[model samples]
Target: MNYYSFLLKNAFEDFKRNKTRTILASLGITIGVFSVVMLIALGIGLKNYIRQQFENMGSNLVMIMPGNDLSEGGFSSFGSSLATGIRFDERDLNTISRVDNIDYVVPIFMKSMVVTSLEKEELASLMGTNEDLFKLMDLKAVEGRILEGQDISSRSKDVVLGISIAEKLFDDAGNAIGKTVRLGNQRFKVIGVVEKMGDPEMDGGIFMSYKTTFGSINPDKNFFTIYVGVDSEGAIEGVKSDIEEALLKRYEEDEFSVSEQSELLDVVNQIFGMINSVLVAIGSISLIVGGIGIMNIMYANVTERTKEIGIRRAIGATKKDILVQFVAESVLLSGLGGIMGLVASALIVLVVRPFFPVALNFLAVFAAIGISSFIGVFFGVFPARRAANLTPIEAIRYE
Candidate 1:
């Protein structure tokens, strides 16, 4: 047989002869690759899901939030509220509404509280907004009707139940409407139930008039966020600048931030990008440990084959031949492990993707396998050289 083919055959024979060592060595790499693949898939899936949610809100959507600096706007600040005591008030909302090229101006208030129905009680978010919120969000009720101008103007105690709360409270959509639910100490009559939005935050929630929220639940707190819909996508930049200029003129310092949907999406991408990198780095730690395992196993293999090495070297075999053979075995072992990991990861993704928003990441898969091969080569070097350097006389005489 050809020398190269004979060396390849020896690699396979080594694995078959020492199944326990081969399996144990390969197991580490399998685990490492699986972790990396799964983590990256999860991160990508969540990022895509979040992006889709924002896109569903509409391309022309703009958000305003209270910030210490004009550029430091954020979505939530449970702790910062106590520290800064800075929040958007009705005056700020009115000022934003006065900006030209704006379609709807709505203030948003979100609070987590216990909601009790006739037969059950559960935790839910109480979202307070004006009647225009429904139009801006493009939300519709599955039954009954949404709030109107009168509801906001009169500060009516009417409430809208999200699908999740409706099901948990009243058992069905039809039975939810016109039901009275207790939010904290106050009672709110459910006038409508919104369709299943699929967003966890908005789905299992209660929608109430902003005036009622401010007047009753949080009399001391002001609005913290505002939603503004520009009349056209083209005019978004112009309107954003105009709002910033107006707010800057009103406040001595940059007390608030104005951001468009596209800009927010960019920020989301950057955050997820960092998170993915960190996750990959964490997962790669396992790969390094696995490489160490491969190295240890390779060293042991060289020890066991000392006699075999002497027999070959005493005949016509060269040091380079022994070196190549050992290296090939190491590469084969790790390559097989990487392939198994890919299969395992693919199976896991199949099982999870149905329940989650995960997608197959081809680049991550390739990188994991490539890294495994490199690990095999890197860790196999010392062992391969040790086997090659054993003199025929010494190796043959060794007990």
Candidate 2:
């Protein structure tokens, strides 16, 4: 028979001779592999979940909110501002659009008032913007169409209802499209209804032309929020920096703040990395416990097979053969456990995927297998060597 076949036969026989002990050793390895796999899968799932949440906000979109500038002795914070003079207007939006690496720039004005229908009345936030707002913010109307340039130029008294507001004012999604809603005692026809935005605050607001809303509500402030989109993924940081510099130069003060999509994603990834590290550290303790169990079982097996070792030594079996047999037994036990653990982990991920999106890392599986096999070899060495070195007479005399 070939060496491979001979080794397999001997390992199987040895396993059969000590079924309970072999099973106990394999259980330890199974637990270790299972812990490591589960921990890794959970970590990846959490990271993906956070990423999806951030993506739901918008892609390659950044908002520059107003802030006050607070400068100490001489050092300036990278993007810090504590002055209250960072009011944005249509002119700022136009200036930002002319900067290099900018895809689109949108200016927003907001106000809160009571919106009333004939049947019911509700409080809602009113947002005003130009036609480019749709493209810059990646917003789409689910029921009807968005506002046009003519609507802004003519200061039309038309309104777009958000999904939640539509539901509250009108009976159904379709009915809300053409119904008239009163905003702050002013009657405006609902020309469109936005799709369900995920955010409760945004879903409770109404969208209108910037000229109309500003003219009707607060026209003198000229204070608004700006949304800027970079030309490409690679240009996000550079574009943000250029916009900040331009604003500082124009305003003659560092009173503006800038945000980038990549910066937000980096913060999210860092938080997830810390969480994953803590989880892996806890899982590693289980692996150490499992390794210790493997060593204990191996020592017990050596004591039980004392007479067997003596009988084999009295025959033609060499010390090398004895050592090889014990080591092979250790590896077979751990290797089988690792395979079973991988299958079980996959099954678990499949079952939980419907409730939570779980991402499996194939690299983590291979690493677990390698570690388990290495543990078998490292822990099995001392016991196997002790058994191989036992003299025939001494082992035979052993009870």
* Reference-based lDDT, residue 4, model 1: 79
Q: Compared with the true structure, what per-residue lDDT tens digits does model 2 show for residues 188-230? A: 9898888776556678888888777665586663655787777
lDDT of 1: 0.85
Worst 10 residues of 1 by lDDT: 69-78
| Each model's Cα RMSD | 2.5, 6.5
lDDT of each: 0.85, 0.77
As a whole number from 0 to 100, the lDDT of residue 22 in candidate 1 is: 93
- Give all TM-scores, in the order shown: 0.92, 0.66
Error of 1 at 328 (Å): 1.3
> Compared with the true structure, what per-residue lDDT tens digits does model 1 show for residues 175-290?
98888999878999999998876688888989988889976687865777888999998999899888888888776444566778877787778778999999999999999999
Q: Residue 316 lDDT in model 2?
A: 65
